[model samples]
Target: MVLVISVTVSFFWLWFIKRFETSTRLTGKPSVIFSLFLCGIGSVFAALFLAELEELLLSHVAFLSPLTYYVFYVGLCEEFGKFLVFYLAASLTDMTKEPKDGLLQAAAVALGFAILENILYSDWGLGILLLRSVMATTGHMSFAVIWGYAAGLYLYSKRAGKNKYSFGMVIGAVCTAAVFHGLYDYFLGMDLKPISFLLDAIVLSISVYILRSLKGRSPYESGDKEAVAEAIESNSNNFHLNRLAGVQALKTRDFETAAKYFKKASTVNHREISTKVCLLFTELLTGSVEEFEAYRTLDRICSSINVSNLNRLRARIAEVFAGCPDEERLLNLIDDLIDETGYRELLKERIAQFDKYANAIAGKGCADSGFLISDKNSLPMAYRHPSFYTKENNE
Candidate 1:
């Protein structure tokens, strides 16, 4: 019953912590589950690590005092152990794909470590259980937030070819967390009634501050434009496979199939522009994305490509506007929304592609959604869009 209650309380707090994080990036829940198991082992490893360090210190470093032992030894060893486990998880997989993921995964590892540590130190009293389980668990998780958020920001902000100062940003977090952990442990160890009372308010305040502060620092929020990532720093194996598949499907005029591949690719690596373009194309053709979204995505992607691809995208956008809206009004909207005058000039090229396609394929609307955009004509700018298709068209 003690163990059950401990786990139940920890679980409730874990969920409570997660409720504060508001990033929309989708990640696999299995990653968190895996971290739980990995960090449970890591807690055992931390115990052994601290034990050896203590013996080593006694033998050689008799100069070090007992008063500061909690800060230097216990805090560093435990934080280092958690860091190793979290690092392995991020490096081995795309566990830290989003900035918010750092917090989530870190919290999982902390909870796992705390739960196991509590289990080992179990006693018969409910007061002891609540103190160890609740206080210890929250402390571990709160300290973890320091490093977790930093690791995530480092991944997001570090451009391709590596940022020289990036290591400091990430490792500094661990050291910071270690110091905080030590101070927290040291304070609690004092056991004075006044100090203990003050520590509770401090812990709750710090946790709330850290969790709330993360909302403003989300990697997706720059310029009010949110994509999966800020930079395409990673080259994913699965992303490459899906990208190739999407390209092939696009060439074959299978827009629906193309979109599926691009969507999967985007999920694998948010930083990749090619995948975003492919997905954007599909959304333009099939999905009911807002007109502003359509214009915003085009403006963002247009300037980054070569003439061939730029013209391809430009011609498609012009064609879609020619078919669906007043070309003159949209031309002005394009000039207003897009930043570059030179880039806007490039989009002005007359390519009446979609109107002809719309005329050619009159009426084959899917019962569920979208029109069949498959081409029977050997058009110059042949490609597939994301959502526009039918059962017959797919066949």
Candidate 2:
């Protein structure tokens, strides 16, 4: 059961990261990935050794304050332990060559530490176990993100013969990670009311944001025209994992998970049209865009003529476009496909091309297209009038 939970939690994150890594220049080599995992496990022992040393020094020496001790010792020790493993991984494998690679490997190492920590804490009870899986694991990974990105940046810049500043940035990043980690644990141990939780939330939120933003800076994100081409170039086994996961979830109509997987795939290659169609299909149909302002994103790409990017999911695309009630304004934009023909003719041709359009909706009612940028785009004035709204704006 312990092994099961560890694999389920850690490997899920690994798979998601692997999907994102598909668009990177790395091969996503399993040798380095699992090697980091094993090193992460071993790092727990390293932390234990460091802790013993810390206790010995604390017993003899005095510290300025409780917070300072935690920051200088507890946080420093734990983070440094992980850093030792990352250093080891870099030395032994070719994995840590890129900044993004550093971030992903950092996650792998953090997961290994989390898994081992989870095993040690399993006797505490299911509640703590579950809580640790999410919060503690996230905290561990979140802290590592800083140092990992820094280390990666150092390697990247050094290789490119660019900035010498990244080396200092790495040291600063590790210190920053240690400070946050120390403060986080210090607050948790102090058990202050909202302060602890608030700080934890801020740290985790910032880490999550950094992870997302770094994806665009990935070297593979050279704005390549083809979606699968990125994966094809990398030749990663995890290529299309997100797309396939989305399809499986879509088959079961598990819109939530399908949305997550498709979103992951899009992060890998935003220009990839197939994932965009499925993601838009699910996000709209589920009304997830209601509060998400997905409309702004939709309008941003209204003039896009990548409809021809549809490849394998022709039947799925047909099914979605034929029946999505939320796409009324999208239909309007489709009708305005200036370079393409009429919506119906396009649908007919699409049907001929993809076996058939599964289900077609012809009801003429104004969909709150602006709910997700339905009418707020620069795709020409083809659908300002509802009568002109075409039904072809679908997956």
Clashes of each: 1, 3
Model 1 over residues 1-395: C-alpha lDDT tens digits? Answer: 77887788778866775564433222223435444545655765765677687768667665655446776677777877787787777777655544666776777787788888887777546777768776777788777777877776665445333553476887888877777777777767776535644654575577567666665554333212122223224423346545656555555566787688789888888876646755775665565566678766756765455545554555544553343324454444445434343433333321234444555564642222233434433333423332222222345
Best by TM-score: 1
Cα deviation of 127, candidate 2, in Å: 3.9
- Taking all chains together, each candidate's TM-score versus the true structure is 0.56, 0.53
Give the per-residue Cα lDDT of candidate 1 at 119.
78
Q: Report the C-alpha displacement of residue 346, candidate 2, in angstroms.
A: 31
Reference-based lDDT, each prediction: 0.60, 0.64
Which candidate number would show the highest lDDT if scored against the true structure? 2
Number of residue pairs clashing in candidate 1, backbone atoms closer than 3 angstroms, sequence gap of 3 or more or interchain: 1
Candidate 2: residue 306 lDDT (0-100): 41
User: How many angstroms is residue 51 displaced in model 2 relative to the true structure, after the best TM-score fit?
Assistant: 2.3
For candidate 1, the per-residue lDDT at 40 reads 52
Tell me the spans in candidate 1 whose CA falls farther than 4 Å from its real position.
Answer: 17-34, 63-66, 123-126, 157-165, 193-197, 200-204, 216-223, 226-395
- Encode model 2's per-residue lDDT on 1-395: one tens digit a residue: 64576568777777766666633333334446666777898888887888898788778675558798779887888888898888777756545434577887887788788889888988988877876776677778778888988887776555445665556787788889989888887877787626766766787687667777776655445322233333333333333656765665666667887798788778887777656867876787677665235544544444344444322234446555554454465444333343243454555554343221111211322233222222233334453333343554542
